[model samples]
Target: MAGEVVGHAAEAAAHGVDLIPVVALLGAAVIGVPLFKRIGLGSVLGYLAAGLLLGPSGIGLINDPESVLTTAELGVVMFLFIIGLEMEPSRLWALRKQIFGLGVLQVAVCGLLLTGMGVLLGFAPAVAFIFGMGFVLTSTAIVMQILGERGELSSESGQRIVSILLLEDLAIVPLLAVVAFLAPSSGDEVGLTARLIGIALPIGAVSLLIFLGQRIMNPFFAVLASSKLREVMTAAALLVVLGAALLFQAVGLSMAMGAFLAGVLLSTSTFRHQLEADVEPFRGILLGLFFLAVGMSLNLTTVAGSWQIIALSVVTYMAVKAAAIYAIARALKASHAEALERAVLMGQGGEFAFVLYTTAASAGIIDGPTNAVFTATVIVSMVLTPFLLIGMRRLMPKPEQSMDGIETVAELHERILVIGFGRFGQIATQTLLGQGHRLSIIDNDTDMIRAAAQFGFKVYYGDGTRLDILRAAGAANVDLVLICVNDKAAATTIAHLFRDEFPLVKVMARAFDRVHAIELIKAGVDYQLREMFESALMFGAQAIRELGATEDEVEQTIEGVRDRDAQRFKLQLMDDLSAVDAARSLLLKNAAEQAREGGVDIEEEAVEEEVAKSTQPVPPA
Candidate 1:
């Protein structure tokens, strides 16, 4: 009877304990995320703060962190997988020189320099090597996220940092293998040759899997996609991830490496976009959880105790790494601004550092106290990255400019005016120019105009919607107004302004759909093109061919569907406009009725009403 009572108490305690952490996590996100956003910092910081607050060192709510750590590992794997999908083989090959050459140089130089410092500071050789490796791998996630947010991901500096990060990730693989071999459990005296062979096997297996698995998986996915079962496809995607992960584990390789290979394989597949759409939410949630786990794992008690040492280490690590990266970037012939940005961006220790340090500690490559110090340093470096980036931005030199013989708009005469210079407008401009038209395009995006100028294209940097700017572009005498802007409301506004201000000009506009085409037609557009209608027809035809339908039958069916939808769309467009007009008329009638009830004679005011209606420009014919 006493034993049964004890068991019941234990069960209740377990249930109560589980609820506390869940509530705390939720509460933190609810309160902290908004607060962080309000303060102009990102939500990632909020999540981290939430984790820290609820962790054992803070509020003491979350006790068992191991489960969260496992999930966080999965998050890292998924993150790498998505990154692999984004990096196509051809693109990877393009960066091969930088990745292998600059990347290898950075890692070797930084690792040796840091290791030498660590050894001099009284660390064991093995411990120093592990520390060096940890410091060598920069935070790909944080750096990339920051660069992407700043819209600098395509900058030369960003590209170099990315290549270096990729190389670091690759380098960590062999480093881990060496650590494993050096561990007591792995038979330390098995010789360097045997250890090297062990490392080569796993790497070779992963390469083979990527080369062969991609060909087989693509067609398999295509078949599954034809079924049109979303749930099944999602299940299939999860299966691929799990299966690849299992294979990696079976071969004693990193699960992330396997998932990455799987992603690369699927990158070339036709269904890549669909797979990304399906897996994106899962990846995001898991990544957030991973970051939270990282926060929870932070031993704030240790940090508080050794504040001075931790602070010095963090500053030293970031300073040394930044200097190294900047020097290497300059050596590679990067511009001064680019070199500075790359150095600052890649100055922090990464998620991989956490993994490497922890694994090395477990393998006895590093002592416990040293491991703790490095871990604290990694966290502090990560926290300081945003501030470092801001400082770099302030310090970097501005680009030089030459003010020599630049032509003003007043000096140019043979100008072909383009109203909108979007994708369609650009095509139209190029096509016309091939036939000897001296075109001068107009667009709102300053970046687009600047880029166009680099390519020797004459583009006017101003909004075409304003009549003054239109006049400035010589709209009265210029050849054409190609209304290629994507926004419907903006397009309509510009069309009205053009018709009212410059009625003699010819106007060709792009329509959103068949209904939009009809609206454009009524708006007195000289020509209208339905953007995606033809593309949709072509897709249907392609589907029919895959489904074993005859070409003629497929063509006829597509044509029939197109004609029917176009007609239906036209009717609907007319009906919608008529309904809107009727509603407006009813509103006016009701107001007039109310006015009459108040003894106002609206019928006698017919002349005033006619004048008001006349002054209001007629709706497009």
Candidate 2:
């Protein structure tokens, strides 16, 4: 038994952080994350559960989990790096107010309140001071994961959350250093100066890095690409991260900050996509490992022994922190529900607290027993956070599940109306929308309307046959009313209505056949188009070319057929059903004669297709 204990201690020691713990951890994550995910508990909770199972409260797989926790800071760097890759400089500038203003207020208010709580709980003022600062942090990994899972990262509140987290990440260095600087015996002048200088260089290392990268990095990568060795580029990418990390660490900054700056520099680079593809796998695995380390580091034995103290501390800390965040968010004009979510989402002790606690313990700012309690409090808050998130889900407004592909017209500052969002209407709407036209699209399908809402399309559910629907869609203000109703009679009604009610609007209607086109002309639509007319013309032209007609011959034959059919279509519009039949007969005879004159023998079907392509409300002239 003595030998076993000694052997285990040796394995857990600084020189030999055993591989068994790593293997056990990976295995547990492999098994646990999916199980938790299946039950909708989320993957972060699964990692924590695995940790609890392997932690001191259960089987002691790793006696000293804090060591692994310390090593897992790399995962934080990777996480920040990936975040940086997603952000452009303009976006960062846009978030500056959130990062500096709201983030600063959150830290100040929460830290002060937490510090007061610690003091009331009988901690020394200095210890309470650092405690407040450290505990003000919430778990970035967990919060970001939750926000991402719910697709709230792009939401207004979620953007603020990200900005606040960035500020906290930046605050760690100064927060850690400040309390230490206050200690009477501390001789940290050089260290303090180095950190200060690091933060405020003339060009700022971040700017310098970006400037240098824009000039040299592009050409460097280009040269590397010429070698045609992908492995080399990947290696160079890793090296870039490493170099940035070293530079920042030398200046007393977070290594994650360095990685983020490096990522931002590469964000707009031509190789950004490839770099992300390469870095994503590493970021994902390392981030998972980081969370797993947090779980393992939970000293649940201490929590059980001091359950009363642990529970009191967590409750007090979360209450104070949440109250502060909620009040601040509300002041910032976040809605009641939004403020509540931000509060609950951020009501945990951050991963940085462990570093702070460990550092304070080493500096004798906080004793061992106090540090243990505080650490447990931090972990307990984190463990409960998944539950908090689950609860918040009940209040958060459900997002749309599909996209209907309709955009509102007035929003785009241009006016176009699309009636009948069927297959034909949808195609026309999509094309017009692509050209920067603002289109108000109305469809009869409620399911399509709801589904489109998910994709952020604002489509109205209404029948095109209703004048009320047309007025609501602002047909009067529209420059063009694209009528693509699949029904021939319904389409004719809409064309006439637009021509009568909104005469200034361009009325273009899709026709089912030549008969529909003539009816649309009689109804006074400005233009009439057969849906498949151009398609048939192209097909017939291709057939003519394949059948040994030269390009000029095919062009001339198609044009001749178009002219003759246009004349026939005019006759149909001028007369009645009998006149249309007579016009078709004359058109076929003329096309066959023309095809012979051009030495391109035209089939009856080919002549008919050309005639269909040739018909217009009025001849081209």
Candidate 3:
């Protein structure tokens, strides 16, 4: 009995020990993320800091960071998968020039420059080449996260950056092959057949993944979805991602690339949205943990022993890489500002350096100590990246709008201040212009302002979201502020700001949709109109007229719609938002029933179509 109790106690203690790391990691993230985000340094830096605290160098809570890093890498795989979902095959094909032309030029140039730098620092040609190539691969996680935060991932420039990153990811496979070729031979050499097999394996794995994905993924998802078990669907999504990732890793391709390819294959699948939603939560958590693991992996002892070497390598490599990137960007016809931005964003050596260095060390290409030092240098460089970006933002001049033919916001004594000069704003201004009411109009788009000037309308260059710009536009003196910006968030912010600070200034805003209109009302705007609402209503009324409805009947039907819409809006304002869902379902059910009575099988034909259409902005009412 005593021996059994001791064994049980020991097992229980082992279980408790296992839970410690999980608790520590979560606690660190919880404490770290919010604090760092609050100060604007970003959550990435926060996770790094927390990881440093929990790491062996700090308090030694988690000694083997490699174990955690291994798991955390899945986060990166999922992140790539999500990115692939956003990139449809057609859109990706559209970016082929940027991906191949620009991406190739940047990587080749940067790799050459960095390799030369490494050799100049007294390393052998092969070793230096390995080091340089590793650094050339930028951290996709860090860059993507920053771009996502800035909401630039969908921007034209952002897509160009993404294209370059994709090329870097592809470069990893060839790079590994190069590493193997460079490794010191141990008498038994790889024959031509072995080399051929080596090449064939990856090709076979990739072909198989494509075949299965194209032929089976959708149908498999369809079957799982029919089970109506949400958890099972989520599990299936994970299984697909991990299975693809493992297959790629086995074939010496990066797991992230494999997951990305799988995502692209499923991009057009009917279940794309569901897969994305299922993976998002896991991606976010694990991605954060990945950063944390990186921080924990930073060996303070290694850095302290070789601080000068690590520091010199970090500075020299980053500077050389940045210079190469800037020069290449300019050569590619990018503007000075864009060149500088791209250089700063991609300057740091990335996570893949560890993988490359470790592999090289195992193959006797570099010593273990050299690997440790280089790894530390990469981590330090990664840590400094956010700071460099923040400093660059502060020092770099904002792209100045040319005031050659455009006026700046100044003390204009107009009674009405128009925040945006877009199509909606231009049309709204026309009514006031016809009445001879002089109005001050401002827009941030230089091209738009210039074009408006061509049309004999003077649009000033200023961002309405800035309080100072608003004041300079005579917003304080204006009796009313007309906010017609197409951006929903910015419009809402402006409306809320005016309602709080310039309370007496009647504000009229343009909304993107019904939800935006409701938000504007809550922001205390005097009036708000969905940009598409009136035009759509007029279009529908015209359609009814074309169907031979009398003018009186058409007018009555329009009035009914208008009244019903007002009632729904009022109910939404009172916070009973569920009414919208209830009303929509009831209407769809009634229509389906009527169709059934009319001898149509609604479920067999129109249910899917109607369900899809119902998700669009609820009809005016």
What TM-score do all the candidates reach, one by one?
0.66, 0.64, 0.72
Output candidate 2 Cα RMSD. Answer: 16.1
Tens digits of lDDT, candidate 3, 1-621? 967865676588787765657888999999998999899899889999999999998898789999999899999999999999888899999999999988888889889998898898888898889888989999999999999989999998899999999999998888888888888888897789988998899999999999998999999999999999999999999998999999999989999999999999999999999999999999999999999999999999999999987888899999999998898889878899989999999999888887899999999999988888878988998999999998999999888766777778777788999988888898999889999999889998888999988888888888888888888888878899899998999999999889777999999999998889988886889888889888999999999999999999999999999999988877676554355555776788788889899998767456656655665543221
| TM-score of model 2 (CA atoms) | 0.64
In candidate 2, the residue pairs with backbone N, CA or C atoms under 3 Å apart (3 or more residues apart, or in different chains) clash, namely 402-451, 402-454, 402-455, 403-452, 403-455, 404-452
lDDT values for all models: 0.74, 0.79, 0.89
Candidate 1 lDDT, tens digit per residue, 1-621? 967865676588787754545656777777887797677666667667777777766776676565786776776677667766777888878889998999999998888877776677667787777877798898766676566567776666667777787788777777887788667675446778987887677877787778656667888888998998999999887777767877776676767767777887788778788778777777766766666676787788789887877777677767787888889888878877778877777887877888788898898777787788898788778767766766656676656443232332332244456766667777767778889878666776656666667878766666777777777778778656788887887787778877788887788888887667766766677777777777778988999899999989998999899789867865776676677666666667677788889998888367347445534533443
Residue runs of model 3 more than 4 Å from their true location after superposition:
1-12, 15-17, 402-440, 443-621
The weakest ten consecutive residues by lDDT in model 3 span 612-621
Residue 289, candidate 2: C-alpha displacement in angstroms: 0.5
Tens-place lDDT digits, model 2, residues 1-621:
977975776667658665777678889989999999999889989988888788766688777776776666777777777788788888889999889999999998898899899899887888888888888877888888788778888877888999999899888888767856655685535677876775586237666667766687778888998998988988877777767777777666677778887887777888888777777777777778778777877776788888998899889899889989999999988878778888888988888888788888887777798888889889889989988878778767774433344433232224877777666776777777787776677777667777767776667766778777777667767798778878998999998788789878888899999989988876778888899887799899999899999989999999988899889987767676446656876777786988789998777787777666555334321
Better of 1 and 3 by TM-score: 3
- Report lDDT (Cα) of residue 60, candidate 3: 86
lDDT winner? 3
